[model samples]
Target: MPRPLDRCHQHLLAALVVRLPPSLAALFFAALFLAFPALASAHEVGLSRGDFVVEGASVNGEITFAQRELATFLPGLDRDRDDTLSEKELTDAHDRIERAVIDRIQVLGDGSACPGRLLFALPVEGDGVTLKATFSCSAPPGEVRFEVGLIEDLAFNHRQLLRVGGGPRVSEALLYRKRKTLTAPIAAAVVARPSAPAASASLPSAPTPAPEESAPSTALDLFLMGIEHILLGIDHLVFLFGLVLLGGRLRAILLVVTAFTVAHSITLALATLGIWTPSPRLIEPAIALSIAYVGVENLYIKDAEGRWRITLPFGLIHGFGFAGALQEIGLPRAEVPKALLCFNLGVEAGQLAVLAVWLPLLAFARRRGWLTPRVVRLTSVLIVLAGVAWFVERVFGA
Candidate 1:
């Protein structure tokens, strides 16, 4: 009886040894290393705002950038080396800060450059500094172009939200390192357009060109933003990867994915629309805990039964994480629905794209007998460690 049981155990172990291609394991580990920073750094990106007002040929505006980011460009501002800028440090370095801001941001009127003059620099209530500047143009501006170069040499991802105002309407554009320039017709030009004649007026007039459309609803932009958010969010990606690593059939995979989709979508919309918002200090750590739970659970569960049950509730917590990012973009009230729809769709699209590639690779591994019990256990251990690290960092960092 002892010999028979030993033989049975050996057979079971052999069956679990899926002969996965060596390259696949290497690829997986490489990807994991690449994403480690995301798991470690809770605040992976910084956001700034630029508000521009165009009056005749002169332009004036305020640019608000996070002090942490500014420290990278102007290290002298952090005089005490305490990793934060003091009021006196900021005041003493006012000239250097002003010059840095002027060199990075530009406003062009018509074909000529509008030289910028820094008027004042002050620290905002939070971790931000506001710089006021005025622009002088050669002629009354018509088509205005805004360019931001603040991201150069920065270690982390940075975004600038630009709000341009002149006439009755205000238009917004999001700026990143790669796409730093935004061109729009000045609201002043739109206000200058002559009124259309009534049908009773006989003179044939050139069809009044429709008022230059305000930046068309940026649905595509919102979609891309969603994808970027997920990709940059290493913790989120790791959680998804843990789900995939568990190995499941198509039907089970779809069930789990659908549950996650529906669940996160609910809270994401609710929180973004100002329905109910949980504190980030709470939501972030909860998300990290969820990741750890999935990984640790994978070590014990031999089957995918009731996996969707885990995904559904955890998905709700992840939704709040997504909402925090979208809120930072400051979606306009009227564009909320469209932005919300596109952003959510984009996240789903990104999730599917990842699964589309990863699932097939995993399937091949499983068929080839690469996923041995030992391999699965090892992967789960790594995932759990990552989650714990993130949880500690986020909680203590908060």
Candidate 2:
């Protein structure tokens, strides 16, 4: 087994890899050139930011958010169908956009409703489409609660980082789908009343438990986000399917899966930690490339022998792909490590769930002699076709 495998690797290296079937190569190369533009964009994280100042019943703020995100809520804004919200398009739809923005985010002053109004909308660089707005309440708030409705409509993994300034130190929170409200306690100095100093001691104690509660909630939400991301990632799933579809010894599948997990985990941690990050444009096309590579590779190898080597490099790319999806590039440093850890864990759990169902079914088919070379060939061809289509879409669509 070892000798034959070694010879196969030698042959692969010598020929610079055997020529792919001519038909497959022709279609892939043709589409690749046509979709070359898509390599310009990478997967971005689902993140946004808002800075608010509270002063005596009035809260005014500016939020920098992903245009694509807002597009999810108001897709019609993409008028050109380019998957982007352009400046002209946004400016043209100013009234509708403004109303939509201010209406979705609510500000509550000391539990009293604060009416919100959009002041302006500006399209910024990258995915940032900025909105400046104000909210008015009956009285100055001792505590300000910001409720973001964006999360409910955006992707499950979306998080909005909020800065509420009425305190000695600005209070911030990362709000997700499950945790949409951020209650920022206004410092006594900012929202002053003469008796605040005397009552401050007790007031501080009341909100002290918040940090404790936040950690768990944040972790759980991120974990679920990771799961949703993996499950919804058609590209990632297709690649995974290519890896294990050949159904072989359980041990071999485990090894291949482990290799992929470790590689992606390393990159995921590194990218999330800001240690090393890859370009967004490079990631999506490369991911498509990985799927194509695997589909072609599976056409030759019947078993999982030496498959880890192939999965390893691509796994690293996959990690960047995962992080790229997070575009959490602007997320708080303090929360990143926790989010990375929990999200990675959730991804692994989701990966296992998928394998648990598929592997056994494949094993059952193998035992029944239902697994045949013809089926594998057809599946591989289909994977190759899908990879080509995705590569073109990501490039041209970007």
Candidate 3:
């Protein structure tokens, strides 16, 4: 068997023979190598969690937000200028953090806006800072509306996992974009209990309702959400673009796409159902690496032979990435199957739509001689560069 380095050289020579001019390819590789030092920043998506309970005329809750997210609201929170935050740093800025949290999160009860009073602010063991607060309404509210505006101006992709409950009725939602307010009705009146001792931030215990009583996400909502997620996810789209850059016949294209769909579907279901889940911190960088691998492979592998080998494993990684989004948003345990099915269907629809538009344009380019071998090589190089940038950003950049 050929040594790994020998195999790599062979692949490079094969790739050059098929498409890339040797001189141009060498120059492109040299440029990327020189620019590697500057690509050390990491990229991340903003996320927060909120759990609220309604009792009588009072709404009490805790919102756990990342320390980095809190820095966006109050820059001074990170006193040492380091990217990482410590407990001492959070304690020093307790008042400012509390004010910011209270100002941004609003709860409306029975059409009247309830004033939020901060109870305590504590830094959790992780990179999270939890703020406990209460909202006092005029009377016992039959319905409550929650609005979370924290980090909205700072991060466009910021999302909040919200869980609200009173009595036996619990509702969960992912808050993003204009879908900030979540309104749910209380199933029964809950009598107010004595306040816990100062410095105690225990969450109120509410019994879980029967599966039938849980508010499940509608099939249409999940379907549309899936479609929207694919359209908005830039990384996933870039990966797909890399796949398309590997020119092939319609049958080959279908086979590659099918492999990706099937692979991701299996992982998506497993991750969504809590059967298996990998941390996003690891998955995100791996995904970028996959994109880089595909782009590099395209440089040498011209035919569709064993292409499914590439798509299958990478598709599994991509599926975990999809699961991260769903996990962040959360799914009702009772409706997991329906939500999973609809969301997967929507993803397929979106992927097909993208291919439908892309394939014909590629064919047109080929027919017109606009897509020369040189152009193909240049495009592949660019894809590789992008993947490298993302990998660096996700792995090291903050």
Candidate 4:
């Protein structure tokens, strides 16, 4: 018989031979998952076009926000230990929040971007707090589409839901223009537009009354949202990818995905609907750590059955991270069921989309006999790298 070292070397050689096919497939998937962030960076939420034109008249609009708890925002400066803020504290707090908000804003059209002046004078006062803002954008002469979203990170003690309502009113207007003829003759012609310019109308103003803080929305929505969140969410997606690499049958993959889905959905519903809540400071770190766990596990484990047993439990912690968005969005009062259903449905849609696009490619590669043990080993290493990246970023807040 050969010596122990020789046997080990032989095994290493075998492993090396198996690596290429899976490595290629795994690398391809990694590139696919990365496309999301690239796309997201391009279509960021915010108002881009400076001025919208409505048939020669420029359009103008403004927005304002007020927040309470002006004092607790600063720590060291709160010398009195009183909950209310002093002048020094107020200025400091506002300055910090304002800067945070401004930094998130991206100006569109014009190359130059600058923080607009804060119109602190439009003071709207609420219980123990007062604030206001006024901004205007003009539209040049012509018909155009206008788009805007709340991109500012406004400060508040609790998260608030913002409601956006607007619809265009279809109306017709006649205009004459000089038409070019085939004979090169300039003739005045009147054209009747088929689609009327339905001006998008928005309500003037409304008070944001304190919310009743109802229970969470429908179970379906909560569940679906959890699915969607996991799919698009890069951290969770990376973890799922590791789970996928274990080379399980369709049933096996479903079992693992179902386990993760059920676990996270449970916590997501509970937390978002107000039954239970986890601190962001804690949840964020754990989420990162979960990625590392999956990565490290991939490096050691080669069997499918063993991995599912581990995936089920780790998936529970991931649910809390999914609940983060719903917590912020809050369940809609009148349409709680609808809100929950839609949100969850959106999540499921996203998850299915990812699976639909990637799974077939995976199947094809497997059919080609690409998922050999060597490929698995290389894939595991890549997962480990991704998980380490996530862990470091989260733990250090990088």
Clash number by candidate, in order: 6, 4, 5, 11
Provide the lDDT at 336 for model 4.
Answer: 42
Q: RMSD for each model, in Å, please?
A: 11.8, 11.5, 8.0, 14.7
Candidate 2 global TM-score: 0.72
RMSD of 3: 8.0
Whole-model lDDT, model 2: 0.70
Indicate the residue-level lDDT of 344 in model 4: 52
| Tens-digit lDDT string for candidate 2 (152-203) | 8776667776767765556666688767888888766455322212111111
Model 1 residue 272 CA deviation in Å = 3.2
- Badly placed stretches (over 4 Å) of model 4 are 1-232, 329-337
lDDT of 3 by residue, 65-184 (tens): 666667766777787877656667766766676677777778899789998877766665434567777888898888999887764654676667677878455777767777888997
Worst 10-residue lDDT window for candidate 1 reads 199-208
Flag the better candidate by TM-score, 3 or 4. Answer: 3
What overall lDDT, based on C-alpha atoms, would model 4 receive against the true structure? 0.43
Instruction: Please give the lDDT score at residue 277 for candidate 1.
Output: 76
lDDT of 4 by residue, 80-124 (tens): 654334444545555554444322333221222222333231222
Better of 1 and 2 by lDDT: 2
Lowest lDDT block of 10, candidate 3: 34-43
- TM-score of candidate 3 relative to the true fold: 0.74
